[model samples]
Target: MGTVNTVYWIFTIGLAILLLTAIIVLLFLWKNQGQLREENRKLRMSYDEIEKKYTGVHAEQLRYKLNPHLFRNALNAIQSHAYQSYYALDKLSGVLDYILYDTDGRLVTVKEEIEFARNFIEINRLKTSPLFDIRIKNKINEADPRCHQAVIAPLSFINPIENAFKHADLQSDNAFISVSFSFENDSWFVLQVANKTNDLPPSLNTRGGLGNDIYLDRLSSVYGVEGYSCKESINNGIFITELRIKIS
Candidate 1:
């Protein structure tokens, strides 16, 4: 009877030891899993940050590529008026200064952008003869509290203006290009550019549309897809491009 009792006690003690070992193993596994999950989450966050930076850099690269084209056009305009007028050279100088210094920045004041557009249109006007009617109507009330302090992506309007000048029928009798800017509903900034198209080959009409695409890409990168909207239409030889941004 004594031997049986001893054996039963030993078996019970062994069983208890096995149960304790199993609990310890489970606890260690749970702790390790939690640590791994934390590390994985941190890694995902790091990846996201890196991706955002890369995308910003890529957008900047695309933006800079446009500078050379703009500079060339500005230089050509200055040369067109060489020895005849210095007004264009002066205007070109200001445009170059803005392009070189201010435009490298991600944003500029609405006033500055409007001024730049005006200067750009002036340069284009100088390039064309008096027969071409280039008109700019700026209805943005500088007195309006929103117009004074609002900021926008630099060179946003210049691309479409450039396209308008490039494809417009400047030599025709009724050649006209119009640019208008206004603040709508006190929350949205609207820009509209329309030009009469020339009777060009089908290929040329489609070829110069890439400038608008680049402009749209830059807008999307800066303001996001939901912050701005763009529309383009062609009717009766008139091509109109409109952009509206939620400024407030």
Candidate 2:
């Protein structure tokens, strides 16, 4: 009977030790798991921060990828025309069509660009009086096949046009915006947009729009220094922006 009791006590003590060891192991594993979860949470927060910065920078780059003056001013001009005329909507569809579809390519034909410029100028005309000094001289031969074959980078020429109309001092009797396009020696093409300057009313105040320098930079980037040349001059309150490019 003494031996049996001793053996039973030994068995009970061994069982208790085993259970204690198991509890210790379980506690250690639970603590390790908690540490791993914390580390994972920290990594997630860091990734989110990186992703947010990347998104902001990407948004900024994409915004400037497009020349804001081209499409934004087109929309504004279209809306203005909506209030003024209904009969000319068909003729004015060029701006809408270009905005929606035609301006998808990296390069566009001289003819199509010229038509776009003409449409833009015509629509802007309704903004001012009939006596406004707005002039357009398109010397490139429209019927020539080269107009289609000789291509240039798209959106290169229209920024200056939008700039001119936006800052033009229409209050002055001598205020003028003139646009001219010509081909030199049939090898290089030229585009010039000029406008007068004067103090504008608070209602017409247009500040902080992209200017000639931006467009000039685009010209240089698209067509290296040898392929393109741009000049901007402010002569006696008249702003002139001229761009010349070798035909592609």
Candidate 3:
């Protein structure tokens, strides 16, 4: 063959080989891309299913956490006293009146909860006559009454507050009580009450009156898993107690 024709033939063969290689590479890439797209679709579906399951689980947890007795007591009290207004006794009765009567939902505001706690604390300090310093710092949320609002359990703190006073020592200066409330995240509402007890009285320590048992039972009934819990610690001749829960 002539030299020019031989070179042309070689060059043409090389070009054909290169074109074949490029076509093979393109085909392999297309197949791999299709598989990757399928995998991505499966992953997205799996993620969506997991998200839905988690939502259902969370909603179920909320349902279980919501105690029925808390609102039930408040509603029953109001229903029982629907015929009368006890405002007339406001002056004659002390904190006990608020504790017992206010359960009817007349003063069902958050402020009333603080007022009730204050009265209970005062009566307790008087009853125990704590020689040690007894202090109460209350921060109440004064909500607008014109707006419709939900209800909180009646006498929510009455038993627990009284229990603290009944069982806590009167001689220790660590007898401090504080109550505070705040709104959070535009959804979560919280109320916290804390107190230092003097010491557990014999009655409380021994469970003689079933006072502690009843107290815990009522808390369980009202708060379920969420209601009336205390974190108690002792330090330097002082005892501290804290209680926290979501109100709304």
Candidate 4:
């Protein structure tokens, strides 16, 4: 009986030591797990910051890519009509200011962007006349404070309109370019541009839609691929492009 008691005490002490060892191991694992979670959180935050910066950098690059195309057109119009009206130079200044200062890859107000498009239209009109079939419809309340606060990617609305002009069958009587801007809702801004396709020389016709590709890339970066909506179609000799963005 004495030997048995001694053996039982030894077994109990061994079990107690084993339990203590297991508890210590569990505590160590818990501490390391918490530290790992913290490290992972920090790494995720750093990755997001890097991604945002990369987006901004590439967005800026895309915006500037077409600045030269706009500049070339505006300067040509200003030079072609500089002798006829002093207004050409004034319009040129506005275009220059907008292109130089406002194209910083930041979100701009709806009013500012539409106004820039209007200014661009007027500048380009120096090349055409009242008889030209260029139609513009605007249905947004610019005075609303929300329109000012609601923002979208800069230079986002111009590509389709510019393409309409560039590819339009201007010499034909049936050629018409129509552009519209309106708010489908308080937070949704939409731009639609349609034009009759023109038959140009192979040189110009071969490179169609290159500008719009850049536009798409910029918007994809700004709003994500699925965040915004775009629809393009061609029917009965008319090419229509519509884009809708949810402003924040």
Q: How high is each candidate's TM-score?
A: 0.70, 0.61, 0.45, 0.68
The C-alpha RMSD of each candidate to the native structure, in angstroms, is 17.9, 19.9, 18.9, 16.9
The TM-score of predicted model 3 comes to 0.45
Full-model lDDT for every candidate: 0.75, 0.70, 0.49, 0.74
The lowest-lDDT stretch of 10 consecutive residues in candidate 2 is 55-64
- Which structure is stronger by lDDT: 1 or 2? 1
Q: Kindly state the number of residue pairs that clash in model 4.
A: 0
Q: Write the per-residue lDDT of candidate 2 for residues 1-248, one digit (tens) a residue.
A: 99999999999999999999999999999999999999989966855653443242322221124455555555565577676565345435876676556655335678877887787687777767679999898887777767876766665666768767777898789999999999888778899988898853222222324454565566665566798886767777888878787874
- By TM-score rank, best first, the candidates go 1, 4, 2, 3
Looking at model 4, report the run of 10 residues with the lowest lDDT sum.
200-209
Q: Pick the candidate with the highest lDDT.
A: 1
lDDT of 3 by residue, 1-248 (tens): 69999999999999999999999999999999999999989966855653443242222222212133433443444345444215312322554465445554221445666666665454344334325556565443355431124334455555445545545555554565555555444443355544554444233244215544555554455556753354544464344445554443
Taking all chains together, the TM-score of candidate 4 against the true structure is 0.68
What is the alpha-carbon lDDT for the whole of candidate 1?
A: 0.75
* lDDT for each residue of candidate 4 in 1-248, tens digit (9 for 90 to 100): 99999999999999999999999999999999999999989966855553454464465643545557676777787787657558877776876787778866555678888988888777777666558888889887778765776666677777777777777777788888888999876767889988887653323223345666667777787777655887777777788888998765
Off by over 4 Å in 1: 1-67, 200-209
When summed lDDT is taken over every stretch of 10 residues in candidate 3, the lowest stretch is 57-66
